[model samples]
Target: MGRELLRIEHLHKEFEGKTVLDDLSLTLREGEVAVIVGPSGCGKSTLLRCVNALEPVQGGSIFLDGEEIHADPRKLPQLRQKVGMVFQSYELFPHKSILDNITLAPRMVQKRGREDAEAEALALLERVGLADRAKDYPRQLSGGQKQRVAIVRSLIMHPALMLFDEVTAALDPEMVREVLDVLLDLAKQGRTMLIVTHEMQFARAVADRILFLDDGGIVEEGRPLDFFDHPKTERAQRFLNTFTFETVKE
Candidate 1:
């Protein structure tokens, strides 16, 4: 097997007296692209947030590259540096220019020099076809453009595992492709990613493993073709029957 890049064991999380993540366990291998799909309120986003340390888990452990994430508070910054995450909202600093937004984290947390950080950020912008917009403010960009900038902001950190939570959900239909294309290129280049998305076609096209989560834990997991076409659990089958490309896109 490929060396495990992320390991989650018996994860348990609660919110307001309700269990949100219940005894969940999963592993992500280096360079593997794993997509998570489930109905709303199934704790998909919570799982990603927990992994990113935006939320604390009540139980279980998460290890990234064999080092425990919650093991050392002093090391949290270092651990986070290796795990990049982007959410549905493009949380760019409204007052900062695109270049500044991309360079801030690297310059501060990463301790990269200003010139070095800008140089690398510029190249990443070019990769996503946003080089010319470096001086533009967040308000000046399209929804797609803003999301692209958010993505590069994460990539600039050189994260080993990238987490995406329904990134395309807020975009107009025409805009989703640009963001997905960027992710597709990243996957092709072999970045380890864990994504929570309802974009079935994108998941089917890119995911190495597709997991169906329900009631706060994984109900079924398999190859994309098998999971979508031949899901093992009734919950998964019902989920598939409930959502289709048409219903989702609308």
Candidate 2:
């Protein structure tokens, strides 16, 4: 564990008068991996969105690296650069080449020279085993490959924290492993991450801490091994029993 990188205190959120999250709080340290898991509609994705400042909370606050997010709307663009987010959808520009898609942010937002941005992008692509696909478009790559490219795109920004919102949710069963492998590699590299996932095995394998959320609040949280093998609450037990398939590779 390292210094605190993200802190959420008394967080609250709602959509159209319906509560999605209520009084939730959490802390994540540098080089730590915290995985949020629970039944669907438990506010897992919404929590990630709040941390990324994509959703405005009704109360409480989120601080990333000591800077309060949502405090200054003007600084959001700069603040967002410190947090990289990957969604269930690949969200790639269909018309752009992989290289161009990955380098666009660094070039446009960061004002890095084209050569420098492209050089780093290509290196990241190669690291993810997609260097040869740099010339290809999103439509040309498989779902797994496109997702890997999305991860590389985020990495090029040099974000201090990465948020994954059900990244494998949209992938085909067979394609899940390739994408999860990249995440496992990142975990090995000690990148700080907060993930919302239903991939139980992968969650157990990668998480430094596990948060079991239900009805918009944390029901139980602890080490992955303890949570999986010995859930404290009946809610967590029932939730774990519902997943029977071995969707994630070892």
Candidate 3:
């Protein structure tokens, strides 16, 4: 029920000759956490990418904080600063030390002083329980550790909205929780986020809204309790039934 921070209106996208997003419209409010769930090739990831102008929209428009994103591609740099994304791949710089990888964007793009950026990165590292590994290179850390660092790197920028694209899909079972814990903490802090993930338990525990997409359109969307316990659409019911888990966290 917070102020609207993002609005996707009649959005459309295509790859080659295929339509990936079909006149999709959704709104995200400040301090809201929206979890996107859909079957493979459903365009969940494409929606997030287009929100930040990472992908071009073939039709319709997206507005972030009331500003039209596709209005001018020239303003993308400024528009992108308010959004941050972490992908399934760790995407950490191989040669750079962990701290350097975290600080690189702030130092180059934001033109932040190295001292200030490092200090902030260190503080964020501590928050994620990885302060001790600040100077270590990406290859030296475990998969979970690298993902945690990636989240911290994004958090350091204090983005208005965070986009996560199947971040835990590449990790082993044990490593998944470590990364999810960081995200849970962020949710508790009331950060506005739009996440595309298959982690059903996390979706139930943290999301204020759950959006179920199918065939490039939203099949259903509502509060967690409503959508999870009583999905209106058959497609959503089928999707949930396939991902059965033990004792969903309250």
Per-residue lDDT for 84-201 in model 1, tens only? 9998998989999999999999999978999999999999999999999999999999999999999999999999999999999999999999999999999999999999999999
Q: Report every candidate's CA lDDT.
A: 0.94, 0.95, 0.92
Sort the candidates on lDDT, descending order.
2, 1, 3
TM-score of model 3 relative to the true fold?
Answer: 0.95
* All-Cα superposition RMSD per candidate: 2.7, 3.2, 3.3
Which candidate would rank higher by lDDT, 1 or 3? 1
- Give me the candidate number with maximum TM-score: 2
Locate the minimum summed-lDDT window of 10 residues in model 1: 241-250
**RMSD to native, candidate 3:** 3.3
